[model samples]
Target: MKQDSFSGRATQGSFFEGLFVRSLQASGPFAEELRACGYDPHHPKAIYPIEVWNAALEVAWRRCYTGWTREAAYREMGRQLALGFLQTWMGKVVDMGLTMLGPDRLMARIPSLLALDTFRYELKVQPLGPHQYRVSIRNDPDAKPELIAGLLEAGLGRTGVKPTATVVMHREQDFDIDVTW
Candidate 1:
């Protein structure tokens, strides 16, 4: 895959970038590292390099949490991302829809929602039961399953269910996520 194949749309990047900058300004403890990544968070909606996005995330993790592992950072980032999403108008709409539908129904709509996003992969969601689901993504070798798992769990939480997600890698560029509540 090309290095920038996973690059996301500028609007998506802006959402994360804005939150990152605001967090840093609010004493996130990784301002310098994030700045050194060289992508201006203040850029209006425009295509951004995926490398910079991932690098910013790494910098935040390393500089902000001195003793944490990458996995721990990812988990926390995911939680923060979920909360951040709720702060935006679009996010609020999605959150309200998800809450109204509840977790199971929301899981069923995940693939379609992902499709509308700028993620560079094909997504498939399958329901195993009322409280179990399987989500598979293809052609995304660099997929951050931890972040995604956090997002899934957080989304389910909004619907009053405690959810757990287990990710399994299969060959190259394939991820299978098993979710249960």
Candidate 2:
């Protein structure tokens, strides 16, 4: 498995597979299918989200459960889960005067985590209170406000990067962000 792509750090395979497999091990509808199919929950390859697991299972069924044929399925599972992690738990929005950290660096840290080679993003910073400011992200220019909020929540979390004193707004073309450095 690969990790820290930009920095060229290798990550353990167990960490990659553990994300989803751990969920299934907790017990659910998906586990029953895997058991019926004779798949090993303890196997390193079984460590992906239920959705990705289902996709692989479909391909596995078509190929008659051949272990050698699962490589593509596993890769696909990695892509999906990687995207989820990137969009969910990375980046922080700080006050404008906090050491000049900008949008590109923030986006780079995130998209790179997913092994995404290319992506498009836009960020806007506006001054508000005496020591407060707003940093709005229009990730997709065509996306509506609701979508932006969803992205913000995923990329920066509902409470956002500062976490101490911040406001997150989701509105198309006109969103509000409050922050105090």
In the order shown, the candidates' Cα RMSDs to the true structure are: 3.9, 13.1
lDDT for each of the candidates? 0.67, 0.37
- Superposition error at 122 for model 2 (Å): 17
Q: Ten-residue segment with the worst summed lDDT in candidate 2?
A: 89-98
- Top candidate when judged by TM-score against the true structure: 1
Per-residue lDDT over 113-181 for candidate 1, one digit per residue giving the tens place of the 0 to 100 score: 653245558889988887999999888746777767777777778888889987766557777889999
Candidate topping lDDT: 1
- TM-score for candidate 1, please give it: 0.80
Q: 85-174 in candidate 2: lDDT tens per residue?
A: 333223122322123534334433433332221224465656565545565655532323332233333333222343222336655544
